[model samples]
Target: MNAAPADQIRLLDVQALDVRLSQLAHKRKSLPEHAEIDSLTKDLLQLRDLLVAAQTQESDTAREQTKAEQDVDQVRQRAVRDQQRLDSGAVSSPKDLENLQREIVSLAKRQGDLEDIVLDVMERRESLQERVGELTERVTSVQAKADIATARRDSATQELDDEAAAATKEREAVSAVIPADLLKLYEKLRVQQGGVGAARLFQRRCEGCQLELNITEVNAVRAAPRDTVMRCENCRRILVRTPESGL
Candidate 1:
């Protein structure tokens, strides 16, 4: 490509800006905060499930306790009625009195059993309540951590985005100063050379490949036309000569 020496120098600025933009994108994607946010989100989900399960268990225990109390109350009332009938001489026959006494005894035993069951249910409810409290606290902790991680991730992404935008603008400005044909050639070579088609030649070395040029090649590049584009013999990247280059 027949680009002026000044235009090639400007194209180097464009290439540098492009490299910076790529680095910013890579930094944004590989930020540590992103991984942290992902982990925190997963933990939050698990904690939420645990909280739900704990609440369900607590509710079930409460319902069971209520039923047990009602049962105890009903049995106690029936026992009281049976005792009153026995004392009032409502059953005159001796066999009938004996049957009434036996009935009262059975009712007392059933009432005691029901009260014990109520007590057990109350204990279970207390345990479940404690578990629910613990699960709720865990959920809160995880949610807080998730919030912090999200904020950090957002900040990192924003910084990278701003940097990339600036680099893009800078690259465009530099690219505009170069000839269209030269830009096209650079783009085509960039694709074929894995995104690095232009590099500085310093001290008889190709900066893109870090390989030294032979004496004949160096001499030829030194004698070549200044406006003509040169390629590295080893890597085929455009060789922009600098004062430090032996060429």
Candidate 2:
């Protein structure tokens, strides 16, 4: 395929734009925030699990405390009724009075034990509450960091996307000027090779392959017509000649 010397130079501009787009894509993918967000997400998950467990324990302890307090109240009420009966002389028999007094003492001890249990349960609940609070704060802190990272990632991605969009537009405009056959050939070669479809021959070297052209290749290129489309023998990419091409 053949294109004018100027058209081949414009192809290089298209190639530059294509390379820029590729670099932007890579930058977007390799953004540091991506890894940061991933790490923060894992921490958040672990923290949330811990918070849930603590909260559950706290709730259970609260119910246990409530039950213990109820038992204490019930025992105290029974002791009050027994004391009233003994004071009213409702149990005339001396044995009955003694039994009533003994029952009152037992009820007091039971109430005291239940109260102790209630206190213990309250202490456990309080500790669990504190744990839940601490875990909640940790989760909040981690979530905030995650949010910031996501925002940074999104902002960086948007900037790169905008730049890539501009480069793509410019590439379309630049590539549009080339002959259809020549552009088609470049596109095919671009796919077959890496991202570089065309490279400049500079100072006797094919920049694509970074190798100096042999004497025979140099002579052949020197004799080629200015309007001829050239391909590098080493890399098989379109060899665009400029004044610096050292013949």
Question: What are the lDDT figures for the candidates, one per model?
Answer: 0.86, 0.92
Superposed Cα deviation of residue 233, candidate 2 (Å): 0.7
Q: What is the TM-score of each candidate against the true structure?
A: 0.93, 0.96
* Candidate 1 deviant stretches above 4 angstroms: none
List, residue by residue over 1-247, the lDDT tens digit for candidate 1. Answer: 6778888778778778877877888889899888888888888888888889889988998999999999999988988998898889788999998988898889889989999999999999899899889988988888888888888889889988988888888888888888998888788878888787788888899988999999989888989999988888999888887677875
What's the true lDDT of residue 179 in model 2? 93
lDDT tens digits by residue: candidate 2, 1-247: 6689999999899888988999999999999999999999999999999999999999998889888988998999999999999888779998988889999999988988888898889889999999999999999999999999999999999999999999989988888889998889889988888988999999999888899999999999999999999999999999999999998
Q: Global lDDT for candidate 2?
A: 0.92
Prediction 1 TM-score vs. true: 0.93
For model 1, which pairs clash? Answer: none
